[model samples]
Target chain A: ADLQQGRAKANACAVCHGQNGLASHPEAPNLAGQPIIYVTQQLKNYKTGRRTNEIMSVIAKPLSEQDIDDLALWYSSMQVEVKMAN
Target chain B: ADLQQGRAKANACAVCHGQNGLASHPEAPNLAGQPIIYVTQQLKNYKTGRRTNEIMSVIAKPLSEQDIDDLALWYSSMQVEVKMAN
Candidate 1:
């Protein structure tokens, strides 16, 4: 359920963020396997303009806290496939 | 050297993103212990406009590839203190 709503909310995100959350965009960070707390915090930033992105701000502006929670749950639930030295 | 340089780069970031990379800003994502690749990729995104943040983009704009590498190296090298449910 959370994942489903996250996927739905992810529509705007997928353009740059990608369907798998692994961004193909050179600049976009791959969220496929990012920590939920990290993801949640970022979404909050976009909502408040702390980390202002024109598109993301608009998309995030209307999102309620529950909506943010749902999206965070959905994105963080997925496994990250990209491997780099840890 | 990398850590020092990253600390320098982190000045603009620390306002919203805490000195430790755990963001006090509701929307900003914490980067203290994010994966290097993820951090690198996100930095690249801000530089290229894929993920636009006014402050970040400006700060990121002047950063060279090596600077990006250094900052990414520094941030990912730290231990993430904020634990969330995984």
Candidate 2:
């Protein structure tokens, strides 16, 4: 999967998960630095109804296997840091 | 609700959501800095079956209203920052 292409594809995810995978909403999970296997499996689970989430199910439904792989790879490669509130 | 008490109560949530509210897993969201109303509502939804997650539902099942409020306040009071990978 092309990392740049994956990043481009990730734009749609920014509304909830931030541009870099940090979530904009409390309801959405941070995808940055997650294990690619875990990310891939969850997307597949959502797509297959093994796991259910209203938004994730819809988002995962239209993604092809390659798309899923690309997305997982992209997110998993990003770095995440948690900073204390000043 | 006491913020300190809320923080203390939030320890159980740390396994999935990090000790400071960033998630340890992609499956869980960063709860830091969320709108308290949003956090509170989601917890209630999980508690009431309006939203479903294998883990969240189980965790929320035993919470009292005060527990929910304290948690919401604790998480919402936290600060979150997302930085790009170097």
For residue B60, give model 1's deviation from the true position in Å. 1.3
lDDT of 1 by residue, A1-86 (tens): 37777778887788877776655564466565455776787889889877776577888889888888877887777643212223
Question: Best candidate per TM-score, number?
Answer: 2
Error of 2 at B82 (Å): 2.0
Predicted candidate 2 versus true structure: per-residue lDDT over A1-86, tens digit per residue: 76777788889999997886766777776666666777888789789987677798899999999898888888877755555434
What candidate 2 gets wrong by more than 4 Å, as runs, is A22-42, A50-55, B24-30, B33-38, B50-55
Model 1: docking quality category: incorrect
Per-prediction DockQ: 0.11, 0.31
Clashes of each: 4, 0
Cα displacement (angstroms), candidate 1, residue B28, comes to 0.7
Each candidate's interface RMSD (Å, one decimal) is 8.0, 4.1
The prediction achieving the highest DockQ against the true structure is 2
Docking class of 2: acceptable
Which pairs, if any, clash in model 1?
A27-B44, A27-B45, A44-B27, A45-B27
